[model samples]
Target: MPRTVSELMTPHPTVVEVTDTLHAVAQTMATQDVGSLVVAEGGAVVGIVTDRDLVVRGLAEGIGLDAPVGQLASEELVTVGPDDDLAEVVRLMREKAVRRVPVVEGDQAVGILSLGDLAQALDPDSALADISAAAPDE
Candidate 1:
């Protein structure tokens, strides 16, 4: 039987408002030990931001940490539904060149699906899966 996104996704992903500061964004990622966050506006999903976005789009551009997180967030958000198939998730990740994708239910972010999540579910013996399954460093 094929797997569904909800089966492999990390539920209740951390979220940040679009108006949040980049500094706050970084702090949240660090404290939560997550690589990405779902960006929201008016209680609706608007975009997504990753640690790489903080470095490449914000820091590398000399953008101030106090700047709004939207400055660095990828507004061209790619998302999936919890009931969607893993194949579709993989396709979107490939075409969009995104490692993380928010899983939504009626415009509300319910979870996050990441490449690492897929690796763990689909190829548990792979290095990526091993690393994904390992506990985070203290």
Candidate 2:
């Protein structure tokens, strides 16, 4: 059977408080080489902020890095539970064009799942086999 979200998720994903400065969040992302950060309040996930959000929403709007991350965070967060199937997670990602999704438990973010992680877990070799099998015989 394919692995579930809990099997593939990165536990204890790096987080940023809503009150944190954008510059600080950016620094955290840069240091960790992650594309998104879960925004938490009172240990509960309230929103999400991404590198794209920083560039498109902040820089494009002339908002300084010193501005609070909450100003640019997306409050309508789409999340997955740890027990959710990986296939469902992948489907959601494709449908939303989002690269990262928080894995929540009772509204608290316990992990994160990224496209790269899914790709690694699913393995492209299976797709290659399917494609080759469908090709016409020589």
Candidate 1 CA-lDDT value: 0.90
Give one digit per residue, the lDDT tens place, for model 2 in 1-138: 466899988999887888899999999988887778999887789889999999999999999989999899886788999999888788998998887899999988999987767765576456544543353444
State in Å the error of residue 67, model 1: 0.3
lDDT tens readout by residue for model 1, 54-116: 999899999999999977778688889999988978987999898889999988999998889
What is the lDDT of every predicted structure here?
Answer: 0.90, 0.85
Inter-residue clash pairs, candidate 2: none
lDDT of candidate 2 at residue 124, scale 0 to 100:
49
Best by TM-score: 1
Task: Give RMSD (Å) of candidate 2 vs. truth.
Answer: 7.7
Task: Give stretches of model 2 more than 4 Å off.
Answer: 125-138
